[model samples]
Target: MLSRRRFLKTAAASTLCLTAAPAILRAKNLNSRLQIAGIGCDGKGWSDIQEMSTHGMTDLVAFCDVDLARTEMVHSLSPSAPIFQDYRELFAKQGDKIDAVTISTPDHMHAIIAIEAMQRGKHVYCQKPLTHSVREARQLSNLATKSGVITRMGNQIHSHAVYRNAAKALQTGMIGKVKQVQSWCQSTGHGKSGFIDRPKTNAPIPKSLNWDLWLGVAPERPYGLQDVYHPFGWRDWQDFGNGALGDFGCHILDPVYTGLKITAAPISISAKSTGMNDEVWPAQMTVHYVLPGNDFTTDGNLEITWMDGGLRPSLQGTHIPPGTALPSSGSLVIGETGTLVIPHYAPHVLYPSPDAKANVEKFVAEPSLNHYHGWVDGCLSGQQPSDGFDYGGRLTEAVLLGNIAVRFPGQKLEWNADQLKVTNLEAANKWLSRDYRSGWKLPETV
Candidate 1:
């Protein structure tokens, strides 16, 4: 992490830290392209590789996925690229050939893959909610700082023009001094919490799927049908996924963090859930945070609340426009002047309402950016990404903390950021991390 003085020095000099890290790998000549590898080459990984490999500076050289069916599709794209079912084998064999990697694996597997890749001097573009646990988030951040590797967390919308304008508007004071903010997403996974039971009878594992490789660092569990916990439904599981708030908090609250310049963890955080069991996420969750605000907020204090599972902020109760209806998934910014309602990645709406819906000239005037290419270029040029691990780790830490608070619903947990502990509740601190199953223990140092 760059110190405050270094940041100021760079800003005043109108320059960036373009010097390559000591561990960075670059061609002897400037004309060579980057050799890239895709881990979990399906779903988001498929799209990430599609976009990134299209860049003039990238070469898709390797693909890794637990499912042969998924790799078959990616294989057609880069037919010459080697394929592997396990990332460890891929790293061991192709370390010399790969320049950087894009990791889109499940939450539980992200840290180990990223750390191993980074330790070998490879840059990384990892998917969101950076890790499965808060402790891992902190560890990854420290490793990134120590290794000085180019890295980015996959919150793609962070680079979009809409979100960029929202952040700019706050910095520009278009919305006067934001005192409070509310963000939310639909609760498909959370709604399933009422029925907190896993399938007692294990379905036959698919021949096409490598269940053991897919499990990775996650504790051993019987594989069920894809509908239960394989391809998509794992988001509802306690062991494999990071619930709704864990999944979407990083993406939804990104603009708020950027706009308000939120640099520290929340002073305190707590949550209340309708009812949650060990099997699934809660049906409903309301997480509250008292953040240490920056220049964009009032008096160095701000209150931000997150809701899901058929919950929405009350615009009528707040300073927002009267009789306003909430969107299925979006954020509401409450300021002294008016409110700014952003519906996910779409355009933001201002309160007291703009006269012409088309008249957003004061808002967005720039073009959207390609997030995948930005990371690729950052690796090649030594330019730090906008949503790099330094920022993403802090955001992930807060989001994971909300998950911890959910375990002890209706109880406040005071955070000691510097110490990375729950100062008030010693018992609650245990939820920050878990003991890795035998072969899954994380190395103490990178």
Candidate 2:
């Protein structure tokens, strides 16, 4: 047998050779770029492209949209990239050429597109409030696990270092046991009332828009100037979108969920809304969710309240400093010992006292990272994404349940997590999963 020193030298040399060999080979393989495709090339989808391309190794292979004008516009920007009207055709024609897909369609189409892409073994980056309904969220989450494809939901707040650091602080008990969280969004309604009764007219579909395909997976309805392309304001409609809560809840409330790790379904959900009748979207709303308390203590409750459309709670005498503009969208966490305040769409600052200057130095600033780059890195490395389907599904469920509450405001909604059903109201249960139009069924994975 070889001496101990001689054997150790041989093993170390072999390890070094093996590690260096991969680096040498990777240098030769530098030509390989991640070929990515974008569906729904307007609105946030354009932003997704800009972010993904920042990594310098991603080639925008294709752009797909029902609107020809949007696809043309994206094609103009990426002259070398191919364009397609139907996403299915685009995938079929270029599946081998593409490495990943980013979906930024309306809520109703999120599950169908994302599920199909994942089934094809493609990594996915889907926009926030992950799905149109609670069932879709759960379905997508399970499918992501089964497919073994890297996935991320578009709750970009998780990518913010401040959000992560704040979560870490909360987890490490910096703020004591968090008992309550208040999250809100203040925005005007889409003002769809006056246009509701307009009679259907047989206007020619614009050359730039494939009107028939734009209404994918949704009920067939006549196309109108207000309905398609340009403004792309279908988000206010119940059939196509989940309204404001579904739009912003994922971004605003995501930090709280990240910090608390509150994965179990809400024990109860209740909503208070204005102008319930003759309204597809609530003029203003407030939703309350009851969650399990901190693990360190027993017999405690954590309440998360959501306010929107200029409807905010009484924050009088709170730790939020005077003269600081109260954020239109953000979270406030109330712990037993103190409070933590995060401003809307900005980095959070710890509030140790009501005075602006107290304990100012203890506040640690967090770095901001590109959310799209995080997903791309995870896709290439096989690591789990920061805001993966598991976290996103739970977040979507909480927000979509708020939509359910708005349908029948003031009624206490009982949720059965295991069964994934609303136990109290049968009429409300119907809204949990919608009927898909023919040829648009969301793919089911075994």
Candidate 3:
């Protein structure tokens, strides 16, 4: 699997060539069309440009958003793109008319606008808890594998079909090994709980809001009044969101790390929450993680956990059926031979006992995927979409290292993930990453 000229001659003899690699991975033109662009266009960025322009092969043109009145319904639907308010001036004045970009903003300007639009090779499509720490989700998943572009992380329910039938029923064993998973989400984000500090009144910024480009790399605050933090309640704040398990742990643990490929690096992590303060996040939480397992998990170890405000998980002994409940934000798994569940985006049941339930119904009747046209057909086939960004940036840096174990609640933390570090504290390796707004930095390569 290392062939890309032996991963650039073994990353040019180690130090991973200092990082931001891709100087060229561009491709597009597979019959012309592409040219898209649209970063933070409006709520969920105009619902991800109305699902990436319903796959008409793109051509949305351009449209950034630092809130020109939230670009009024994506300028009444594309209306000749060109809306800019700074996505670094939409790539310093339309970087060659863009070929890909989606970004949905606000998670602290997702790794500096996807590391400056994948170092101009373009093709991004970020969203979800893609970044906003955990070292910008491990440097935008190693700069989307050193900028080969064609990335995707808007965990749009990882292409719903209830998570491709719970990632094809736990990678085909139809839920057999999977040591223990459990998830949740029912509250926080409207159920309330985040903002606990910093908003000692500043207000007055709104005149169509641009409050310092919505506090770009954070660290500068002021506007706090429409239920604290900017428009979408800034997820609930903590330098602009990462709460609610980094706002829905990469969408309910993306089928427990894409049906258990898990990509290692979680020797531990812990939490218990409902306490944090220095500026929000913690109404109810739980976390946990563990990982380090493989062949679909069992004795090798795997755990997981999570939870959110409504805080659930122990349905007494399991079976269910008597009115079957437990969902608000789902994912259960369990498995030795059966459990499953799912619920969040719906349908995935399977119990096998209490008078039979099963009903997974084949990856939810197949033919579904359109998560923003699967990143516009993976940018015209350079491929890499099922939540790409090197597998959704290692499930968003292990769900933002469970928000640094909810800032030391029970204090487990360990991780290492090939030196992305945090090896047992040093103040949990200073929450992985921060410090951007002193005239903003990023760009150590991309």
Candidate 4:
């Protein structure tokens, strides 16, 4: 088993070789023409395929999904590609032929499929939040390192020029001694409590869907339309998803964490909800994170507030200084000198008066590249990806901690990052890991 230190050293060495390859030699190598496969071929997965194709070197070779209809739909986009309903079979049969696998599946299945691919010597790109549980995130990161595979988390916004600029600006002290961060996702979907469970209904599974495979690492459960497709709402269920915080927190809070170089777990976490139930949604929910004060010595302390599902910070009380449209879903950084507001989705923007639109004087704007291709390019050339497993796992761990706070709403939870456990809440600590179904054990060290 590779120790964490050894794994990082190997990854760094591999990154050097990948990034130093000459353009002429790179173009001539057929092995460099990345043959890729897609799992969960609808929504983000479908779009990722299109984005990857634009890189000119990617060959869309296979598509997999529990829903046959989804696989067929994706096959239309790449008619020559083979299709499979089970990802395990797809990986086993075609692992060697493909250079990488892109997992844009629901949050729960991420670790199972990604770990399998990495063990088979295939690079992987799994969507964020990287895993359903904190333990899964750690395992995935460790496995990627052990297998010597290049990996990326699908927080695509991280590749945006503005996000990189935001980090650079903060690093250069453009934000001037940052102190507090406010991140939010104004979602109406998971209002109060997240997804309500379907009553014990024996609804027949869809003919086109393979129910067992969809459940993957989650506990075995009978299928329901509510559980599977249409409205595509599995995100609200605790069994297969992480609700709103898990969905948007990875993308929204990532920039702030990255710019700040926050690696340790929060010293404390607390949450409140307007709507509470046996299930996960709090209607509107707010989570507060008190990071260790030592990370930013100049700033006495830093706090990150996560708001979602109709819960949000009041613009009136915020320091935006009026006349500015509050960002619907993004982050607000309160620095010693001024504040910066960034948008949630694509085309992340910087804010506060003239700086919001003034061509971002210190930054460069360039056409966006596909995050999947960036990983492939990095792998083949031995360059480090911006959101590889180590960084991705950390980001996922941070966001998932917010989910843990929701699970133990109103409790002040203390975390021990080195031990990877919640120190103050014994009940909450139980959720740090999960039991995989039969035949689905994560490697002990990887």
Best by TM-score: 1
List ranges where model 2 is wrong by over 4 Å. Answer: 1-32, 189-203, 227-230, 277-279, 296-299, 320-325, 353-364
How are the candidates ranked when ordered by lDDT, highest leading?
A: 1, 3, 2, 4
- For model 2, residues 1-446, the per-residue Cα lDDT tens digits are 22346334323332111111010001011226677899988778878877888897788888877665555446655677766667776766676688789998878889988877877778889998899989999998888887777889987868887677777666666556676788888763334332333236656676556665677778877776645323456766677777678788988887788888777889889998775543257767889988777672225777889988876655654565556666677788876555677656676666554333334456465688888998888777778777888888889999999998887878988888789988888788887888987666666565
Q: How many backbone clashes does candidate 1 have?
A: 0
Tens digit per residue, CA lDDT, model 3, 319-410: 44556677788877777756778877887777755434344454435546778787787778777766788787788788888877778898
Alpha-carbon TM-score of each model against the true structure = 0.90, 0.86, 0.35, 0.85
Q: Which residue pairs overlap in candidate 3's backbone?
A: none
Worst 10 residues of 1 by lDDT: 13-22
lDDT of every predicted structure (CA atoms): 0.79, 0.73, 0.74, 0.71
Worst 10 residues of 2 by lDDT: 18-27
User: What's the CA RMSD for each of the models?
Assistant: 10.1, 13.2, 19.1, 9.6
Instruction: Name the runs in model 1 displaced over 4 angstroms.
Output: 1-31, 191-195, 352-364
Score residue 230 of candidate 3 by CA lDDT.
Answer: 66
Q: How many steric overlaps are in each model, in order?
A: 0, 0, 0, 16
- 1 or 4: which has the higher lDDT? 1
